[model samples]
Target: MTQKITIDGKDYAVGKLSEEARNQVVNLRVCDQEIAHLKQRLAIAQTARAAYASGLRKALASAEVVEH
Candidate 1:
């Protein structure tokens, strides 16, 4: 079985690429994986931030009721 890679809407066999091209393909794959990981982390951090904001709001509201 042969592995194929697509670039610019065209498909080419990985085995036919030069060593430099193959290395570049590997780099592109690594970068894509890293980008996906960072996106997930950002989503998690945003969710946590939203939770923290909500908690702060509730705490402040409680404080105001106690002071009245």
Candidate 2:
């Protein structure tokens, strides 16, 4: 079974992909890529948070030692 699909304003003839190709596109690769991308973003956010907390702690310690 073959079907025609339009993509980017161009007509493309797409035949029914094999079972493996269909599974890879629909099940495996898309979700895996999304999960990997999210994990990367989470690591960056956690690092920024740790840096901010460290800066805040240093400022607080300095303030406590200042005698007025």
Error of 1 at 24 (Å): 0.3
lDDT of 2 by residue, 1-68 (tens): 56655546975455655666555555655798899999999999999999999999988987857578
Sliding window of 10 residues with minimal summed lDDT for model 1: 59-68
Highest-scoring model, lDDT = 1
User: Stretches of candidate 1 above 4 Å error?
Assistant: 65-68
Model 1, global lDDT: 0.96
Estimate TM-scores for all models: 0.87, 0.57
Question: How many clashing residue pairs, candidate 1?
Answer: 0
